[model samples]
Target: MPKHSRHSAKKRRDPRRKTMDQITAENDSMTLKRSLTATQLLLMGVGTTVGAGVYVMTGTAAAEYAGPAVLLSFLIAAASCLFTAFCYGELASTFPVAGSSYSYAYIAMGERTAWNISWLMLLEYGISCTAVAAGLSGYLNSLLGIFHIHLPQWLTHTSLQPVPGSEGTALTAGWRLDLIGFLSVILVTALLARGVEESARFNSLIVALKIGVLFLFLIIGVGYITPANWVPFIPPAQANFHFGVAGIFRAASIIFFAYGGFEAVSTASSEARNPTRDIPIGIIGSLLICTVIYVAVAAVLLGIVPYAKLDVADPLAVATQIMGKPWLALLVNGGATIGLASVLLGLMYGQSRILLTTGRDGLIPSVFSEIHPRYRTPARGTFIMGGIIALMTATLPIDIISDLVSLGTALAFAMVCFTVIWQRNYAPETKRPFRVPLGGIRIRGFWIGVTPLLGIIFCLVMILPLLFNMVHALLGGNPVPVLLLVGYFLIGVLTYRFYGFHNSLMAPSRPHEQGTSSHPE
Candidate 1:
């Protein structure tokens, strides 16, 4: 070979540049049991995707942003997620692995990008799990109220509550902690540590019950439609992202949290019986099903009660109360309580798997990679993440956590879309059981497909409002969210530089350590 060609080859062989074959070898070496079927995977996606959004976020979006037009917000958010879901389907099929976007980035971009994506997954899965747990606490409290059992406010509420006249611009600490939310995480973590198959079965049952509750609401609540409440479906502009056309977009961005879990199916690829085909089915099918259910339920919810009255913790329960049906309210709250627990299960499960994959790659501590000998699950990592989530759930308010989760989720999704385009351009010969539709023109030797391009654009749409709101909040004297995000980014960078950059399994010095046992050092 020519001298220049030899130099180029040597440079391209950097450890960070993990090839598709390397990723496939890693997948082949995974020990997580392959017991989940297409049906279970679909239910997992649905179980995670359908919660908090319908049970909690819908009310906030309606009352605060788009009013009755929050249904449009659901459609808009679903549209964006649908595109990204396609990108996820393609990537998951091509590279069925545990890390989901992180593993995909490792193959398509490099280790630095994979590390960043992994950090974002922490925000997406970990914090989102916390947010869901917080929402579940509200439902549980409401359900207990139906039985005339009232928990103490300090025990049921978040420690940080928004200031009354601060319009969510300020938070004040109080002697409060969501005990139910904290305990809920612990229980689900134990369930996940038990095994994936058992968790999937539990998730399936919860998904069915929630779906039935939503259908019940639709069937009965549709009859209570007050046409006047939806008079101005698109309420006039009161402020930026407050009750106008912009509000629809803003609400879409906020409620985008609702669609956060579909990609979680991709994280289950390592444990899938037939990942190539099943992962795609799970990702896309669940999104389509949940979108229809979301739109239908939103319409019924708004018709039964004016959007103005929906800014409460338990919106469906509030709606049932307005209709003078205590029985229905009890059932709705019951469904939400059980339903959000499944979301916790799915999110925590995905978070642990991401930690396992990242740890195996040496981006984080190896303890996270430790799989239980008997259960074949990442028990150690699950317990650790669950503890963090439980603490967050006990302290932070859901509104604050949800926005950060949505921002992280949107960015991760955009990276997933870009990975598809990158892989197609660089590794055209790679076999893909599923391909994102809408073939596109090659740009300077890079295949920029239409579907992935649209996915990227929609993802931006879903996050722009969030960015704007964060900026607005900063200007209005609330720098908490922005500071939190920046702090997280800096922490990620510092950790990568100090540890991951040197210890990565792909590092030249650690080449032989790529598939070591998942026991702690």
Candidate 2:
């Protein structure tokens, strides 16, 4: 090679010039304000998990798939989430970083893996906030009608959305926009831009209100559970994806979104006042709580109404009406709004944190990592993402884009489960305040930890159908959100090429701890 070119190549390979390597132990540049208690973290988890899935998914899953056995579907989904939650508990304690799975992946996998996870996480947050906002819009409008306040149909509906069951345009006649969903994202973005502490406090209160509303549903609706509804619990499967055992698995996969909040907890590890002790508590505790709520609500919802009649957007509200209680319906609608707001808050908060971590590692622009001088949050990135999401809500009918968030999140969970076992084998000496139980029992040749392995399997099981269906849609000429996802990933690649790759702050760092005890020095 020529002398100048050789020098340039040497500079590129210089250990000191490496960016992601520097992001290993702890970050030095971007600092997030730490002010959340364990309760706040738990609240954030519960708020995120208990949102649209319970309010919207329960009816649909029960109606279309699991029948009354939707309760079993909830159990199956929650169990799958618990295994990954154990892995998250350990990583949150081990790294105590803002990036969550991306941080753990950095330690266990490599810089490139971490960057990819971070990119996917950005999608997770953006799409989650978008979908939740859209769902919340419907409930919000319903609640508004209680006070005789109703927006025009065109302002409230999306444009040219094909109706799911039959030949239709998702609504009657004229071109329209889902303005309410768009405004919902704008409102959440504004709240998150302020700071984490404020957001957590608000999330906690919302969590409490929604939990109370759920309990009220159980308290009232349980008495009216007609014995007939629970009889054919696992209704026979009529078709491939409809009611049966296959339907239960399908329901579990669909309802997996109910557990998105627990993963969101790890993103707040940096902000947790006592991360090592509290993150585990938040992750596991919230899973347990949400599971109980889902099980009870599913049973009651199916009991109050036939499983066949439970496919509406607002299941809990529908249950109340069947029981001849419009007042209860109003309260349930109120809870749904609070539930969605908290979900959006958690998703957006996690999204910005992922961006901050990515930027800090020079995997993206450092401007995203720039914390507000006064608010102590990633204000610029939060608003940018918010604007991006708000624009999508207004212009793009995101019916398909929403599941992209769920897919990305499930992929991240699987990655975290992989990280735990990898760390157990690779860095056993590393300090972990919470470790996954029944671990390190190697099976056969290539397997080690059983807990995380189950998590990985289940995660893949959940993700595969979504992948297949998406590809199926693309092949059928509906190349919508898939194309958008491709574009988004292309943008990330360009960002990496233009800025992240060469500017990375990586330095040589030990992947495994060098302990005097282990070394016997």
Candidate 3:
């Protein structure tokens, strides 16, 4: 082949292999304001981390899978998250960009990989935001019940629900919509449109309030521990993912959704006042804090009530009711309602930012990249993504999609870990303000660091059970989850081929194009 032809082919193959300098230049040019401090970032992580899973997943995981061993499940999930958190810290410091893992992937791997990671992140944050909103609606309804102000069932429930044991293959329809969930998304969207600083402030306040309520529950509920309830702590296996050692890992996968908040913090790297110092602090600090709180809450919750009876939407409220503390139950419900809203804020914020970055790259419409001149936020993109999530929350059943969220999160985390290893080997001279602890050994031509390797392994461990369950469901006549995943990937591929491939800023023919679109309306 001719040398010029070879050069053109190389450019076509890897057009978006951004160097560290390019990434830094892009960060310097970002319109997003850098008003967030380390403290607010940490609180935002906590606010997003300590929501639906702690308030809801714990009970169902305990009742159906881990039983009293659910506390151990929390530990396992935290451990898996810890290694990825370290990798995120390193990558965030190395490339403090708004796209988070997507940015890291573009710099390390290429644009195609980055686009897929961004797509998976969309699946992660989009569904997660909707799920959190749906959870908030349930808690909100419970809180209103305390005041004897009941909403009509049609207003409180979703219009579509997955059939019990259908694994998402069967759905039941009704004249219903979660108005509270829909409105909550709109409210959070408005706050995010106002600006990142205002949204972080609201999240910090909610985090503080929810932590206080949880600590109160711990203080009062500890004295009521019925030690007998913990007998046979690891329940015997009844079926796949049902009460055994397998169940413990299964429960870990289910609750992994709660640990996703730390990832959201990395998305704010471009907005952090001190990305090098503060991003790591926010990522690692929030994970450690939320883990301890999760374990403590799980212990107290199981102690106060039998795990068998804790599968309801409002598990903490159930425990409080069992303790005959209607007031505490009200408080817990109120805290959950408020806390899940913070999750919505952080997730929606992260999702919109990801869209902004992708749009700037020309993988999607440039309109999403438009920043509001006054608010300095992705207001237009925020409304578009929020509307989709709100519509989904109001209409669709989320139960079957919950595991899919965990799967997407694990994949994105694994890519982040791999990016650290890739950058370490390919761009060793790049200055890193934060490094994943534990030096690595090189095998053959590749250097594999212990932290990132373990991160990948742990993510795979978290993913295996979920995959097994998906296969199990498929074989048992429930193919919705697997089909949905495949369909989503196909959509991503078609999008890249039809739109992203032609319009990409990094295309060989458009090497010098700067993405300076007009401001969003």
Candidate 4:
């Protein structure tokens, strides 16, 4: 290497050049205003958390497994979430950082763990944005169809296959690609680029609108509910593949995606005024509120129509259309369009922060850690993430994308629970504001391991049913589909090995405290 080139490399590697904390300093930087009260944060969580998953996935889950026993599926999912939420609450209260579990893992487990968590989160947030963007486009097209406005064909068609039963027959189908979905993704990226407060306020308004529409649905739709629809609540599955307990567990796995945005609350922790108190309130409060709404919506949906008649492949607009009220369908579609925008923004914010954290730790390129000179946000990383999602939404089929989102999130949650258990065993000194009580603290060594023991078991049990179903769904249908998913994880592993592993910030820090902010220490 030339002398100047060597000097440049030395400069790039200089630890004193700037720290992540320095990059995040309030001076001459756009500080994220600590304007979100617990109420706003809760609303933000709801805004991001409740979207296509409940409005669309409920029917699909009901059709595939659990039948009307789908209600139990949700309960099962929420219970698992409550346990994970306990884990998240403990971590968020202690660190109160932007990267959520990825950050928490970094501080507790070391660089390698942090890199994997961030890699998994990248899948969870970015690809999920693509899925949500596609969802928003579907709703928008339904709304526009009422006005006799149609989207162009070029935008709608992409290199993806429609789910087997979902492809309308050869004669009537106009086009396969979705242009509006791509546009919606771009629009959301634009909104995110503008700023966080704007995004939050926009989300708050949409949350109010969607919740109101849902309540109206409950009031009006619930009245039309007939007892006939509720019978055969646990219908038999095809091929004698009847999953009683297993079906509920599978439902729990799917519904888990519906509850994903609860972690978005933690992304704002660094900017929160009293992060320790507010972070937990934001997470727990949002879950409680959304869970109630989900149950109400499920009850009304199943009651109003037979589970067999529900369109698992179609979006929620069709469900309302079947209600024989086109205007209500319009309202539902509009609410969904607005509702999913908030989901995109919250998710985009999360993706950027994780990228920023990864860069700060030298796991990728340091440029990713760069905060916008004026916006004080991870502007570069945000743009890169949003652009990739926009392209994905423009091209990919919805369920294909959704599966990746669900798979990634499930893996991440499973790991998070494991990390919490690992912490209790190895790092007895770490501060935890809220701890899951395992009574008889001084009993035999086995007693000390019980809380973590149960937590790990809980995660594994929750994961098993879905793993079986997805594998079956993949094999029973096409092995190609399963290979594609494998491809995604393989890419993640390769990326980590060549880029993330060599560049990781963990080499200098103790594994147990790898990702903590150097400033705090």
Root-mean-square deviation per candidate: 3.7, 6.5, 4.2, 7.7
After aligning candidate 3 to the native by TM-score, how far in Å is the CA of 134 from where it should be? 0.4
RMSD of 1: 3.7
lDDT rank, highest first? Answer: 3, 1, 2, 4
Clashes of each: 0, 7, 0, 6
Model 3 per-residue lDDT at 128: 95
lDDT of 4 by residue, 1-521 (tens): 23464355444432312223433342123355566678778888888898877777888877776778888888777766776776777778876666787777765565567667788888888778877787777677767888999767666555565646632111122345567777776776777666677777888888999899888878878767787877887765544234466666677677888888887887777667777888888888888888898888888888876776665545355557667888888888788778887887778877776777777767788776787766666677777777777777766665544556666777787777776765654445667787755532433331243444455566666666556656776656645446666887798789878876666655444344343435332
Cα-based lDDT for every prediction: 0.86, 0.78, 0.89, 0.70
Candidate 3 has a TM-score of 0.95
Number of clashes found in candidate 1: 0
lDDT of 3: 0.89
Task: Name the candidate, 3 or 4, with the larger TM-score value.
Answer: 3
Candidate 4 shows a clash count of 6
> In model 1, which runs have C-alpha deviations exceeding 4 angstroms?
1-15, 166-175, 514-521
The TM-score values for the models, in the order shown, are 0.94, 0.88, 0.95, 0.85
In the range 1-521, model 3's lDDT, one tens digit per residue, is 33464355455545467766666677677678999999999998898899988899999999999999999999999999999999999999888878899989988778899998999999999889889999999889878888999999999989998888765778999989999999999999999999999888888899999999999999999988898989789999988889999999999999998899888999998899999899999999999999999999999999988999998888898888888998888889888888898888889988998999999888999888888989988789888988999999999888888898999999999988988987887667778999999999877556799999999998998999999998998888888889988998999999998999889887766756844321111
Please, what are the lDDT tens digits per residue for candidate 1 over residues 184-218?
99999999999999999999999999999889888
lDDT of 4: 0.70
lDDT of 2 by residue, 4-54 (tens): 643554444323222223443345345667799998888888998889888
